[model samples]
Target: MAYFSKHYHNPGTEPGTLVAKSDLGRPVTIHLIDYTEDHLEEVRLANAADCREYLERESKTWIQVNGQADPETLRNLGDLFDLHDLALEDVLNTGQRPKLELYDDQLFIIAAMPFYNGDKLDIVQISLFIGKNYLICLCPLDEDPFEPVRKRMRLANNRRFVTRDIDYLLYALLDLVTDSGFPVLEQFGYQLEEMETDLLENPNQRTLARIHGLKRELLVLRRVLWPQRELLTGLMRTEDPLIHANTQVYFRDCHDHSVQIIELLESFREMATSMLDIYLSSISQRTNETMRVLTIIATIFIPLTFVAGVYGMNFQNPDSPWAMPELGWYFGYPMAWGVMIAIAAGLLWFFKRRGWM
Candidate 1:
């Protein structure tokens, strides 16, 4: 539920310098998936040097680094792949916006994978370096959104997946990451529907808070997805040889998915805003009804108070001819009581007829 921004270097730090801000104590894990038309192999590499044979082989290789390794390991990996220092630095610095950069020999891509854990949306950044025959993926955690893609690659009956180039693999990863947002957006849709019902029936402070929280989360989602749409568009439009023509089509599909996510976020935002308005209007209506009842009670008491004040006065010289004769009559008190009763009953009847009681 808290907002997160990218970590920047010190004011005087040189640009494109690698800075290690992650406090990950665990050792880095390098997993390699090397496959060809007729063979497949998966290995846990001991170090960057163990990847030399796979990089030289005539098959498609995918090297997945589980955690942000120590600075030395990252530098060694960068040297092995000839990856630019700036791109490596971006991989270590978390919370980067979704973007795509084309290097002379590799395509660098950063994507945010969003998922719903309990009631909050969690986003994990996945950085990829795609080259002619190999793809390097750097993830912050072991559990990633690409597990399904891995499973599919494992279960394929023919060479359909293994025979493809690395660009297709890049597309698969991007597609998986883009498609992950749908479930999170679906969860939000259900919650917003329930919230709208509550706002109409019985709104309270807690409901308003939830609405605001959802709005903030939606904004975060929007911030993550808008640039992603542009990133996909750029990938599709680029003339880089690393991205094949067929791969551009897949990127187009990913672009469409990003657009859908952005549209959903916008719709949810508008719904949250409407729920807030409904809550306020509900409170105003209740206040008006309460005031109406209080006004009726005060109006009924006005004439009764006047009659009591008139009878409460004292009169001198009661025996005088022009004195107040009713004060000496035996029926005076009863007549006054009768008049008060009549006044109350008449007013009650008038209110009942006007439908104001």
Candidate 2:
């Protein structure tokens, strides 16, 4: 689970107030992209305030804050950039579900990017603020996964990010964040399809746990991604002129992307549900087989036990009333043994005839 901030404030609350949580990740390095249709400069920054002039300029600027371990630095950046208080609050609080907020002169969007931390899927929080001329991005503590987007931004042919306003930059970032989930879900779907074979052959404790774990991961993925769909929906329908008419076309593309992700999620959810049923049926079938074997054994033994009990009884001699005198005969024991063998053979023949084995 992502470390949720317990004291995190509400969405509309005052922004600069601190939310306390011990598991906050380490500080992230800042990457600066100062670009326009005519010029381009990509550089690293020791201080976030170095781009003040760029943010104030007419060209598009992007300042990506990599981590949130240092709230003071984030606070300073928020202060310097005139970011809304609630927006900064969202930065420190990892539990904030993905959402889109329109602040005065800026659009605040929160998104969770999915990737494999190891063999497991993990979500990295991405906070984006699309302002007049700059797009500031933030992510969980790690190497920025948006380097590919950055590379594309530098390409001369990609007017989508270069020539359009910052909203397009946001669209590019969100599109990349969303597009990455397809592969993860595709791999998951493949794994689930593979699970069908195993679940049928030998469903066990470990297999059940894996199914549950996968379901949980899907749930969390849905939790983070569903709202992003709505966010994109809002962006598509937004009347803010900050989103240029040309740019709304790209936003419509983004809206279609949201639908794609949501549909994929729904399909994966069905797969998970089906796997659960398969696991249950597999277990039931194994149980039934075990019970059948036990019942067959008991059926084979019932007649044999009855014969032994009848002969093992001690009856008086025939000389007395109600006595069994055959016991006094010299061959009585052998006769009893012979009778038992005959009875056992007859029962075995009957069982074979009935297909009890």
Candidate 3:
């Protein structure tokens, strides 16, 4: 896994070097939100350069790009902002854990957005470059999952992203990232119920494997998410002028989000462990039933085998009184069969009354 971790950077020898992950899909799609306290403009840019004019001026600008497909365009954006080399590298490296770094003049944040609303567990990597007056976010996917945040920005009275300091924009984005996890956890809860159903109705090795796989995915998510608690904690406690004093309260909310996520994860782990126990208990119950039936059958057969053995013994003649004289009786076979049936019936009735049949 060091290989994957090193994919974030090629060690700490240089500040701004290009070690972009080779597997990045393509150059990103660009969207722009140029807003002031009173006005807002949302548009899809044909080029990432279209926002340069707004960035040059003194208005709140947001140039959000989805996915990191084109390395050249990312490099160019880094150049346009005079981004620190390390910050540029962070933009291209898609696998880093959630982090917050205050570089030369920018607050570069790389965080994973957890999404489980859909079929699979989705984690979108979002790298934000927050400058003095502009905010540029590089999303790891082509789709925009921040429409709710965007909708909030459009409201006339609550255009906080436009009127507030760059820190508020960062908070909104991180809030979006952390908020997404709660829904994913909800979806996981649903899937876990499905797992339990399959376990109860008809347990199988395949179901067990799925349970293990899902637990492992949750574990991986836990590894990525718990550190974000510290990240938010650090941001809230720092005295950085870039982050306004009032912003700590918002960061506290984000910290609470992380706590909720951690608690949910712990709950899921406990449920999974309980599920395993339920599975084992079911198997033990089934095995015990089978053994009881077998023991009852053997008990019923023991006396019958003894009676047959006595009749099977060979004895020489009329002088041997211990011999089975019933063999010469007029209706010996019918009498023996009637006796056997009566014994069997009596044993069956006794077992039935005992609730062991």
Q: On a 0 to 100 scale, what is the lDDT of residue 293 in model 1? A: 84
Give the true-structure RMSD of model 2: 3.1
TM-score of every candidate = 0.91, 0.87, 0.86
Model 1 TM-score (2 dp): 0.91
Model 1 clashing residue pairs (backbone): none
Looking at model 1, residue 183 earns an lDDT score of: 94
Q: Cα-based RMSD of the predictions, in order? A: 2.4, 3.1, 3.2
Backbone clashes per model, in order?
A: 0, 1, 5
Best candidate per TM-score, number?
1
Candidate 1 residue 97 C-alpha distance from true site, Å: 1.2
Against the unseen true structure, what C-alpha lDDT does each candidate score? 0.84, 0.78, 0.79
Instruction: Please write out the lDDT profile of model 3 over residues 1-357, one tens digit for every residue.
Output: 122342555556576667656677765788888888878888888776666778776777888888764667777787788777676776676667788887767777778877754566666678888888888888877778777888888887785677688788789889988888888888789879999998889877888887887777788788789878878887889777778888889999998988999899889988988887888888788889999989988888888888788777755377787776888888977887788788888999999998887
Across 1-357, the per-residue lDDT of candidate 2 in tens digits comes to 443422465677664676656655665688988888888898888777676666567777888888663667677677777888767777777667888887778788888788776677888778887878888888876688888888887777877666667777788888888888888888787878767777877778887888888888888888888888888788888888677777778878877877887798888888888889988887787899899778877776677788677667878575687776666779988887777678767767887899865
Candidate 2: where are CA atoms >4 Å away? 2-15, 19-25, 314-357
Task: Please identify which of the two predictions, 2 or 3, would achieve the higher TM-score against the true structure.
Answer: 2
